[model samples]
Target chain A: MAVIGVALVRLRDLFGVVMLSGLFTLTAASLYVVMDAVDVAFTEAAVGAGIATVLMLETLALTTGREKVTRRRSLAPFLMVVVTGAVLIYGTLDMPRYGDPGAPIHQHVAPRYIEESGREVGVPNIVTSVLASYRGYDTLGEVTVIFTATAGVLALIGRSRRTRRRKGSQTTGGDQDAR
Target chain B: MRGNIILRVASKLLIPCILLFALYVQFHGDFGPGGGFQAGVIFGSAFILYALIVNIESARRAVPAVVSRVALALGLLLYAGVGVAGMFLGGRYLNYSVLAEVPTTGQHLGITLIELGVGITVAAAMITVFYVFAGEER
Candidate 1:
């Protein structure tokens, strides 16, 4: 992962950067798998590595392939990154140790979900029970957020006149023939 | 493209497999460590793959923005509707136990429905975002 990060920084070619970022995501997914978070691993793999890479490649198709190197360097960004990392590390100092059974999180409602989900939710998968039943409101909110994002994207760039014209000229059942 | 017959043929073979896996992930989520979010991204990537091979315009025609738009809202509605139904059944918001006569069965029905809703919304949102971003020049 560090190697990929170094390669990403050293390579000015935007395509290489995108590819490396995908590699980075895959690494993160692997790390999640090692931590036994299969669902999260799946999400990171599918979203971070798969769809994001394709979207970036599509963006690359419309833009320059290589990055423009700046002659001047800014220390502000580097300092900001260092400060942020330090603060995050500091914040983690108070976090419970990994997988401690006595941790507050484990002592909370998680135990009830784990113990009673089979009888209550009748779902063999505790994770699903928690996500869809115990915390259905959060899932609803997440769906709504996705809907809003789609709406925003549609409003912003869903229609492109050049695409419409080219599409109209191409085939009988093209875009313009309908709208 | 080099009229890349290999890319075309391989994609044709792979697209079906990808879509099948996406469906598998969606339906099989309750039993294992899969769900709507991951399945939806995979589903969206299938279309993105098609767009990569052909063009965004053709992909758009195949999917159509209107379908995505409707799906986006419909999924959210289904989720919230389940909660509303719970209320109508004299339970608290999102109390799936009231969804059916049998509490366990109601849970199964509620979770399945809501998961399906999540799957639909996530897939639609992802596909729509890809279309907008990869559509054309500003």
Candidate 2:
């Protein structure tokens, strides 16, 4: 996957890069599905595969098609990555199995969400009940984050035609013919 | 543009079915494995298909940029509004039992509203994000 990602970066074709990114997202979503995180997998498949890929392609339309190769080989980042990988692997030695039935996660508040949530919130999908009711505030904050990101993207993209219209008719008059 | 006609026609038919299925998943989530988040993504995927099959501009016209923005805000407002309503009913924030005079089923009603809010917000936000990127110059 990493090799594919690097190859995608090196490739000049923007459409190919987008397709590669979709592949990476699919792989990640598959991993999430294997871990029983169905919701997370669904999100990765939708947002990563569907939206992000489309966005990247749109951005490609406005930019140079070819990637410029640099001669300089930066070894510092590679060294850092190796060290980080070693540390991460060492840290994972003490972690439990992927689907350990006796895991602490299954024993704690999870049971409440699974057992009591149906009676309390009256929702069969425990995840929804937890997300919308038990931890609703967090989801609200998430929505705000999305809103902020959208606003940021729009601002960065600059004012649409409406903004120029408000400024004056001078710019719009010239662009009207082009459209 | 050179793709199979069958694929195009099938996608055209499948998109609306996907959306209807998403709605079913959202509403029937209280009795199944699916819920607001999953339903939202499914719903968004349906629109994304339409955008792909028809054209981005046509999809934008169908869903409209301003309508999507309003839908996004309204979703959050719906969720928060229910919580505020709970406060007015003399309970804690999001306390659903106080929503109705009949306390037993009030929780059910509250959960439904909250789920609906989540579904709306998620679906709109997902679609809006897609639109933003789809229209981007890069």
lDDT at position B81, candidate 1 = 91
TM-score of each: 0.90, 0.84
Could you give candidate 2's per-residue lDDT for residues A22-139 as a string of tens digits? 9999999998888887767877887788767766766676676557668899999989999999999999898888778688888888877888886777766677678767887887
Candidate 2: residue B114 Cα off by (Å): 2.1
iRMS, candidate 2, in Å: value is: 2.6
How far in Å is the alpha carbon of A118 misplaced in model 2? Answer: 3.1
lDDT of 2 by residue, B33-119 (tens): 566766777897788778877778888889987888788888778888998999998998887789887663777788778778878
* lDDT, candidate 1, B58-131, per-residue tens: 88899987798788888888889989999999999999999899999999998888888888889888888887
lDDT of 1 by residue, A20-125 (tens): 9999999999999999999999999998998889888878988889899898999999999999999999999999999989999999899999989989988887
Over all chains combined, what TM-score does candidate 2 have?
0.84
DockQ of each model against the real complex? 0.71, 0.54
Off by over 4 Å in 1: A160-179
Model 1 clashing-pair count: 0
